[model samples]
Target: MEAHALYELLEKYRQGKCSPEELEQLERWYASLGKDRPDSLLEEGSEAAQVLTSRKLQELHASLGRERRVVPFRKRVLRWAAVVSGLILLAGGARYYFKPASRQGELVKEYRIPAAHSRHITLPDGSLVILHAGSRLEYPLAFNNNIRDVTLVGEAYFDIRPDTAKPFVIHSGSLRTTVLGTAFNIRAYEGSPEITVSVTRGKVKVETEQEGKLLAVLTPDQQVVYNNMGATAVRQPVTADSAIQWVRKDMVFENLSFAAVAQSISNRYHVNVRFEDEGLATCPIRASFNGTEPLETVLSVVCGIRNASYTIEDENDILITGKGCLP
Candidate 1:
């Protein structure tokens, strides 16, 4: 059963609307969770964990009846915390049971992309993720709770599956982005000067995890840049597709200088690029590459555009020489 379904069933039980069979099922599921190992709930201060503890305590009090001496609220909360933590840990197993016919679990899985390479992953919920070079994504094998949560490091593009009842969330460094099934790109590489999130479809809510403060709510073609050094964020309009150009391996240049173009190429191909003449660095380039073409082919075209020539040395270093662009 999905998290939303379980939530609805619990609500019905609370309201005394469950049938006898349904009540039995709920009791069985709760008993199974009670048997889970302790030490699993890591986010004790989180709202969700608090809610779980409260609910467990209420159920326990109801079961024990007024004849039994009431435990202090503080003591009850501590005991329930252990129980809920065990439940969460059990949720990470490959198969946890609500019943024989309805087994569910959300085991965590992680993926990492090496330098100079990219990878594509289809999550358990059918969300598509394109992980850029030097990035890592940690997601669950299944989404079992009220939220779909994942963590990202470095850069990645997400095409999320829409489920209004469960918001998809990405935790990157200190930033948290929440969306209800949208397409977006995030760049949050460690040690980077800034973290940027750009939306292509639907909307996204960005926040600071530590303070739970809202930073920006962005729509299509919108982006937010968070400066790590200044601890500030700014929103701006941007061409959304351009933000994910690397996913398609499409190199696009619109009136960019040779220096900028060289840097882009160096980053993509993991090479060092240099202009032999300082003047040539200022030459403008207007071009597009599908990335299917060889690096040499792309370089030849760029050099040809400015009446320049290039030489490859030591397999990874590139040198360009030319008379600067037309005056």
Candidate 2:
């Protein structure tokens, strides 16, 4: 379909003059032509048609040392104009749907993680969420007239602002964690072996709808993990000062096994650390280090303390093996 036909069809559709079947046929034709057109043709210039003509014609002209261009100048110009105008309309439509309003205050919004990195997002209600790697967080483009609600995937830590009348509820998988005015962490990695909820400050009530049970009311320095088998609550002492060290370019490892440490480091730096030594996986260590330093330096220091050896094959791959301190 050409640009004139497309514009006519669109106008008819807006006026409700096109039949359903005609509209469908027009849409199909538009999709087929749009997919085949080169993006460069969507720009204006003398070179636009010069780049898209038939390759066979180019070879023939080369052999004869003579050019036989078929496209008339007026037709070429109109086609180019249509291409540019179509691109502008498409771009404007996309921006209208995706970007937030400049001055619109407090609208429900949704955010998703397309890559590995923590996303620092401020919600419409002034609450903040630090979305961890491989996570999804969705809320309305604007919040409700009263309370604030958001859904989560993977893991996220929330630092919520106080609102007396409205409470915040985060839905993770089937579990719902609710809080009035506090900060907490929720880990619900998809198909992960466990779902964890840790609270550094304030209080949160975690509820499981499967059994209609209140699993735990977590306070500061408390955590709960729910798996298919069951849920367990642990009351452990943790420094609130460094609860979210990952966001600060630092990771706190407290008596973590080698395997667990490798996973944490991988998520923090977006790199992979593997232990080739089978025995090294179980070696335990308690450490915290700044992420600003080269990962090799941190790895060297940790391996030195644990009596292990490692080699970095490249930027993303590090092999930690050989001797490891026995637990």
Candidate 3:
């Protein structure tokens, strides 16, 4: 069927004006098109083609009438997009609705964790997430038929449910992780030097978002680190517990420099720890806290061990001064 004919039929369907014969004809055309050349529905960068594609979507929603529940308009649009996207893909159609603009109608729910705090979330798919301090996660109000996808900033630990038909996907910065069911942790704080994805169980496929290149296929006790500055990834083996200590509110420092320590402390305590002597920033410290100690106590232990002195300038800032650590 011609694009114009399809559009007219869809418009009629949307208005509930299609006769039984016309409806059957439209459905047959849809099935036939799916089998033949579904990609012809939309031409790239063509305004007229986009309009027809959008109308076809509306017609599909109207025909199904399965999504008329009490939900936000944007969410309804997203549900339709997801369903259509899956159907088209299965029919060998061009991937159209993946674009942000095409799926803009899908409502997004965002959760943010403030400094010195964390939050636990249960997704619509029964996936569990623990968002670390100063982090944010954005996901659809409900997953689409094709995929369970979410975007994260800062850090989070995920325990995704098993759904082989619809994979769970996470997007952090330029990295994307896809898994059927897995336990993993992702640290992608904006200012952090790298984005890290560590898998604790099951398997995950990590890829670069821009090029859609496979970076790694990680299994249990494995991790992939993507350097934000260089856009490079390195896969390595690690102990799962070490990678996910933050979920337990446990802080572990293993021969880490003061600067790195400060960053971790700042994230956990929501305070700025500054080094008065820049040299002290490189001092190494090895410590572990169960996250039960008060911030002041932790700081005191750290300072006393390093022969450093610290002062709380205000509620949100801490200054540290000491002689440089002996090499």
Name the candidate that leads on TM-score.
3
Q: Give a tens-digit lDDT track for model 3, residues 192-290.
A: 889999999999999988789999999999999999888888999999879988765636788988888887776665566889998998989888875
Candidates sorted on TM-score, descending: 3, 1, 2
Q: State the lDDT at 210 in candidate 2.
A: 57
lDDT of 3: 0.72
TM-score of each: 0.46, 0.44, 0.48
Angstrom error at residue 86, model 3? 27
Per-residue alpha-carbon lDDT of candidate 1 for residues 1-327, written as tens digits (9 for 90 to 100): 344445455545433367887767655554444333122332566433533454564565355333123654223323342233334433332222121111222334556554576655777788888778879887765788789988899999899989999999998987999999899999999889889999999999999877988999999999999987888999999896698788766378899998998877775655568888888999889999754345688799999999899998655568898776557
True lDDT of residue 73, candidate 2? 27
Q: Which ten residues in a row have the lowest lDDT in candidate 3?
A: 90-99
Any residue pairs clashing in model 2, and if so which?
107-141, 107-142, 108-140, 108-141, 108-142, 108-143, 109-140, 109-141
lDDT of each: 0.71, 0.62, 0.72
| Candidate 2: residue 11 Cα off by (Å) | 29
Give lDDT for model 1. Answer: 0.71
Candidate 2 TM-score, true structure as reference = 0.44
lDDT of 2 by residue, 1-327 (tens): 555556565545433367877667654653343343444333444332333344433343243222114444223323332333333233233111122342133222345555666656667787878787668886755666576777788888888888878888887876888899898788887887677788888998888745657888889987777774555444455555555566654356778887887776665544557887768877887887643344566687778767888876433457887665555
What does candidate 1 score on TM?
A: 0.46
Q: Of 2 and 3, which scores higher on lDDT?
A: 3
